[model samples]
Target chain A: MTGWLSIFKREFRAYFATPLAYVFIVIFLVLSGVFTFFVGGFYERGQADLLPFFAYLPWLYLFLIPAVAMRLWAEERKSGTLELLMTLPIGISGAVVGKFLAAWAFTAVALGLTFPLVITVNFLGSPDNGAIVSGYLGALLMAGAYLGIGAAVSATTKNQVVAFVLSVTVCFLFTVSGLEIVQAFFPDAVGKEVAKFSFLTRFNDISRGVLDLRDVIYFATLIGFWLFLNRLFLDNAREAG
Target chain B: MAPRLEARSLVKRFGPITAVDHISLKVEAGEVLGFLGPNGAGKTTTMKMLTGFLDPSEGEAYVGGVSVADDPERAKRQIGYLPEGAPAYGDMTPRGFLTFAAETRGLTGAARDAAVARAVHALSLDRVIDQTIETLSKGFRRRVGLAQAILHDPDVLILDEPTDGLDPNQKHDVRNLIDGMRKDKAIIVSTHILEEVEAVCTRVVLIDRGRIVFDGTPAEFRGRAEGAGTLRVILPADAVEDAVEQFEDLDEVSAMDRHPTPDGRVRFTLTGDDRIALINRVTGVIDGAGWPADELELDAGRLDEVFRALTSRETDHQDSNQGQEVRA
Candidate 1:
């Protein structure tokens, strides 16, 4: 009802007003590139898929998204700007959504700048553009999930380090749930259930050119759940202040 | 219609500590109410409740009659709040901050531009609007906070320590600025400086130990100085002792103090409600004693006296409450 477009605009531009956006984009691209070309054997694998690049994304974003999102509310709280923000006419939900979208969008821009990886894959062999698109889709959704968790953690404390550490810990749990190393400790039935909930498993399915509705729903629900938690944490902090 | 802002028995507590306790206040349109208190007197807490940043534990605050606890989003539309620290995004420039404030308040297109310009001009913020907030001086930062608080031109303005970091000249400038806004908006400016109340505030509300101890006009607050009224009496040094002794027993006289003078003129402070009546009594006492007075003067009471009288009692009262807290 209120014009949230203004909130959307301001938050979107705030990322670029400082070095935060530039630093984040440069770090994300360099690390993703390193993992894609040098570490993941992008050239040696000779695969028509973006398996090398997609494989490192969950880990890459685990750290990067938190760096981007950690200051979303934590800095606001630290600087006493949360009071200034909360007094504005816009609804809390709108501001949260706008901020989350802006951070996610910044990551998306960084992700898009990695087009050279797609180009390299195309140069070596004809890679399926459809799978590549889905890979990027899964990567973007996973980044959102990570950013949402980061936003939630950022809302909990005024310390950015604490927010970053907590976000990585949460995202790592979600990623490693599907790995045999993590699942081996559990009973067979529980292990499979945990693996089914793994972020990597759902995202891996999409990058394999499989448009599973179940995987889409998993990512969407994870994002929605974490965002809901983000809002709850913000409300608690507001009431606490 | 119902004053610009109202709080009905608002109470805010954190665990065992009560920050704001059963405080109620009203601010009418076009009136500046000076919210006066010492540190930790719940001034910030009360302002936070009014701005909907903190939910009251027991009661409601209304901005333009819209309850903050009931509908904070709606209530925020009618009120502008400058928080205690004036916390702003340090990375953003004043331009960015004001634009964000304007947009968040729902000003659009040219109206938004015009509002931003007016706020910048009103606060004399042009020099630093494009610079990051981290680079601004403390005075400029406070002005930026002021600009954001009034960017929307809301009906009610709640400023917590508005001139805290400014120099005397800047304080005078800000006082003039607040005076200019006195025609159409209700303002609540909280400060530890008692002089600001006398300078710009129409009414004074003194909070102590999370309670309103005094609420009245500046004149009434000054009138509360019973033991500190300045009095002038020009009598010979021989008659001075007799005058001090004779006049010190009046029901209104609380205490007396002599002022240093080279001439034989008697100078003393009288503790009384009516300075004129005290003066008449002193005249009568001195006239019959065959002392010819050369001059008689009655200076007004200073707010410093009122401040000390009220806050000194507050500290003693607060200490007793703290003892009760320890026992509990």
Candidate 2:
């Protein structure tokens, strides 16, 4: 546990040690506001809920989370610090989880900064605070899933650009898997199965304040699955490098 | 009672190419083992395996009697490794990086502070402790890497080319530090610089083509050359041909060469198995001939000659093997 905490602290501090954290937060906040007000027409609907903001959470995270996670292992490998980290007394799983939690926490900080939307919704009309809290929870969980995938891809290459592009492409498939346009290409049975795996369906459930146990499990398992793959890839790289 | 570091037939293969062949050795406490090799001669690969950074394709490595493959985390607790180039986080200050290293090594509270302070003072990093690593000079950066490796003060230290790219003063400082620490730890330092072997190592292991070609003390290595205990006499140029003929005819002199010196003197070098007997016989001849000699000296075996002879011989053997395949 101490090893994990040490890595987590170093990784988290590393984010703010450079301009990456500030740049990412600024871009994420500005895009979230733009998409919510102009694209989703929050005021035009005149509703007292943050559904407009939640609607664009997955798409917003598609780019933002990868930017945060791309440097997690890619930079370590490029700088040759991966060898140093791996040779430490820490276990492989501890390092992977520590790095993933750091990136997830960074994204959560960016998500937390969007509190103005919650304030605006409450001022306009009576709102279900329970749903607002669940929406934030759902967004954070989904970010963990995206970051897990990004961290795994980042471990496969030393190039941050390659990690970014590959992660975005993979996340895109997960986001749009349930859409009618995508499901149309498959048979009805296979399409339903594919939709069952889509992050959109699960994220929407939490956004609506349902808080289904199964949806929570879905995101948790997805995060665990990708992080396991990340550990395997790193371990293999140590042998093959 | 057990060796602090040991390798049993460790090997690493990448596809069809064998990077590290089956090689084994051991180092006890208070011993400095110098690992010498030519380019791509498996020095770094062997170190990587011993440090648990790379898995060997065959055999195993142990630290303090613990197998690296069986429990790498436990085995790693006993090692402090400075990988090639001394890589570190560029964005981090020396203080931040050392703290992180200390924390990961399980030091905390006052202990962590003390360790970091000790490393800083030991490497003389106080000047750049708070500066970002990328902004520091190469010497400072290398020292920072060294500080991180020694933060935990493990029983085993594996350093690959630790003095590479450092100026003379910095190199001297690093060598002093290693010398100080060798009293309680088993140290393995891989280097290409021949003089480093004489400077610090208690035993030297020379590797060629992923194999141990020579292993011995510094003096023993120098003794391997046939040119050991040669006598050289500088006579006037006019007496060169006659002196060479007379020296060659002596029973003690096995071989002799004469070359014209820049100062119009003929330099004759005589080689034989026994130095005292050979010099006595040659002096007798010289006195009888009454040759006008400017200087007389004896030569110890040169290390550079032995190193070149050993490695180049391996290359020649490989070249001829390839030639035989081409003809067949």
Candidate 3:
């Protein structure tokens, strides 16, 4: 447990020590504002809610989450620090979980910075605060899911570019699985089954003022699954090396 | 009491290639074991398995009586490993990197701070402790890696090629550090630098083709050389044949060979069992002939000769086996 906390603290502070954290946060904030006001027509809709902001988040995350998670394992492997970290008196699972949590927490900080949007919605008119809270929970959970995939893919290679591209492609499949354009190619039965796996469908439920237990479970299980894969990949690499 | 570190029939295979064949050894406290091998000779692979960075395909490595294969975390707490190239997080300062290492080793608060301080002071890293590692020089980078490895004051220290790329002075400093620490910790360091074995290692393990070719004290290794004693006399190129002819007839000289140097000087090396008699006779022969010579000396045994003799014998054995296969 101490090992995990030590790694978490170092990994978390490492993000702020470099320019990556500041640059990523600024880009995320600007893109979120642009997507909400211009692309989603927040003012025109004037529904006194952040539905437009919540709707554009998955698309924004397809790129941003990979960027944040790409360096989790890839940088360590590339710099040869992976060997040092592995030889320490810590379980592989602990390091994996510590790194994942650090990336997830950083993403949450970025998400929290969008509090002005929540404040703006409430000041404009009477809005459902409960639904807004659910939306934030749903976004954080979705970020965890995306980060999990990115971290797992990052462990497979020492190149961050490869990790980023592979994570984006995999996350895109999850994001668009339930869309009519993708599901149209399959039969009705297979399409519904594939749609059941879509992150969009689960996130949509929570975004629409409904905190479904099934959605929460889906995100939790998805995060666990990918983190497991991350640990396995790293273990294999260590042995193979 | 159990050995501080032990490898019992440890093996690591990658599909068709066995990088580390069955190898076993032990290092008790207060010993610095020099792992000597040519490139790709499984030295690093063996160290990796012993440090719990890699799982063995067969067998086990124990640290402080705990099997790394069975409980790596427990074994790792007793080890401080400096992997090849002395890798560290290049973005972090040495202070931050050592702090992290100290913390991961289970140190905290004042203990952690004191550990980091000791490491920094020991490695002379105070000047560059706060500077990011990527910006540091190669020698300083290596020292930081060393500092991290010794931060927790582990019971065992495994360093792979720790002085590989450093200048002479830096190498001297590293050797001094190892000499200072060998009193309490069991240290294993791998290098092809034969002189290093003589300099710091209390014991030597020489491996070739993923097998232990020789294992003994450094003095024992030098004693294994083919020539018990050698008399070297540097003469003019034209006089070399004359010197060899004269030395071959002497009763004390067993074998003689003339090696022409690039500087137009011919050197004859005379090997024999009796060092005192051989030296006395060789000097008499050279003095009687009145042969103009630049230098003359006698060596008990040469390490370079021993290393080459051992490693080449393995290659020769392999070649003969392959030749037989081709004929059959």
Candidate 4:
């Protein structure tokens, strides 16, 4: 736990030490606001819930989360600092957990900044706060899942752009699994199975004022599975070098 | 005392290229061992294996008797490694980077702060600790790297070219710092500069083409090329063979070389570590042989010559072996 916390602190401070965190937060806020109010027609829909805001989150994170997590290990490898970190006393798992938590927390901070939208909705209408709270919870969990994949991809290469593009491509696959065009490629039963495994479907279930135990386990399991792969990648690189 | 660091039959290969080929070495505590090799000589590869950054394809490396492959974390706890290029996050300042290293080493609260302070003070990074690493000079960046490596005060330090790009003053200070920590730790420093090794290293392991050709103290290494007692006599051109015959009875002067100069004088070169004895015998022979010589001097052995001889022979042997393999 201490090892993880130490890595987390280093990673968190690393974001602030440069212009990355501020730039990410600013871009995230402006885009989320623009997408929710203008693009998704939040005011036009006139819904009492945060449907417009939550709907754009998965898409926004697809690009923005990769931007944040792309450099986590890729930059370390490019700069040859990965060897320095790997030679430390901490295990590879600890380093992965530490880095993943830091990036996830940074994304949470970006998520938290959008609370004004919650406040704005609460003041103007009698929206169900339970659903809004669950929507935010789902957003946070989905971020962890996406960032876990991003972190795993980041460990595979020294090129940040390569890491970013590969992760975004993979995340896109998981996001569109439930869509009709994607499901059409599979047989009827397999298509249904693919749709059921889609990230959008599971995330949408929680955003609809329903926090199912299965959704929680799904996202957590996905995150854990990717994190395990991240560790394995790190171990392989350490041995290979 | 047991060796502070040891590698037994360590081997590493990348596809067909073997970087470190079943090399073994040991350094006792308080010894500054120089790792000498040319570029592409697998010096850095050996250090990485020792530091547990790269697992050996076969065999094992140990720090304080803990196997790097089996128990890397425990072994690494006793090691401080400064890799080539001394890479660190450019976004982080020295203070922030050192603090991160401290925290990773499990130092916390007051202890962490104290460790950071001590490292900063030791490296004299007062003015630059707050500046981003990207803005610092090469010397200051090297110091920051040194600071982090020593912050934990590990018992084994595996440094790859620690003073590669430093100014003379910075190099002196770094050498002194490593020397001062010698009694408490074992330091293995690799460098291309022979003077740096001569200044600080107590022993040296001269590696050539992934093999250790020489492993001994500095003085012992210099003593290798001392040849069969051969003497050169300097005399007038006509008296060369007479001077040589005069020294033939001396057992210490087993062989002789008398080369005639353009100026009509013969110059003799002597080969032997016992210069005084050789000189005395030559003088006795010269006085008895009635040969008048203009000048005689002793030759100083150069490390550059030794390095060339060692690396070239190894490369030639490797090429011949490959040629034979192709023929087969």
Best by lDDT: 3
Per residue, candidate 2 scores C-alpha lDDT tens digits across A1-241 of 3388899999999999999999999999999999999998999998889888999999998888888888888898888899999888998889999999988889989999999999999999999999999889989899999999999999998899999999999999999998899899999999999998888887887898988778889999999999999988898767656
lDDT of 1 at B206: 89
Ranking by DockQ: 4, 2, 3, 1
Give lDDT: candidate 3, residue A102: 95
For model 4, the superposed segments whose C-alpha errors exceed 4 Å read: B226-299, B314-328
Model 2, runs deviating above 4 Å: B229-300, B317-328
lDDT of 1 by residue, B108-135 (tens): 7899999999999999999888999999
Docking class of 2: medium
Looking at candidate 4, what is the lDDT of residue B211?
81
Of candidate 2 chain A, the 10-residue stretch with the lowest lDDT total is A232-241
Task: Provide the TM-score for each candidate, comma-separated.
Answer: 0.88, 0.88, 0.87, 0.87
- Determine which window of 10 residues in candidate 1 chain A has minimal summed lDDT: A1-10
CAPRI quality level assigned to candidate 3 from its DockQ score: medium
Question: Comparing candidate 1 with candidate 2, which one achieves the higher DockQ?
Answer: 2
Q: Give lDDT tens digits, candidate 4, residues B1-328.
A: 4579999988888888888888999988889999998887889999999998887889899888888888888898899889998988898999899999998898989999999999999889999989999899998988889898999988999888899789999999999999899997899999999888778999989987688888987655655544423445567878766666666666666455666688878787766555557778777777776667666665535666677777787567668788665320
Off by over 4 Å in 1: A1-3, B227-298, B317-328
Error of 3 at A131 (Å): 0.9
lDDT of candidate 1 vs native? 0.84
Answer with 1 or 3, whichever has the higher TM-score. 1
Better of 2 and 4 by lDDT: 2
Candidate 1's displacement at residue B270, Å, is: 9.8
**lDDT score for residue A229 of model 4:** 95
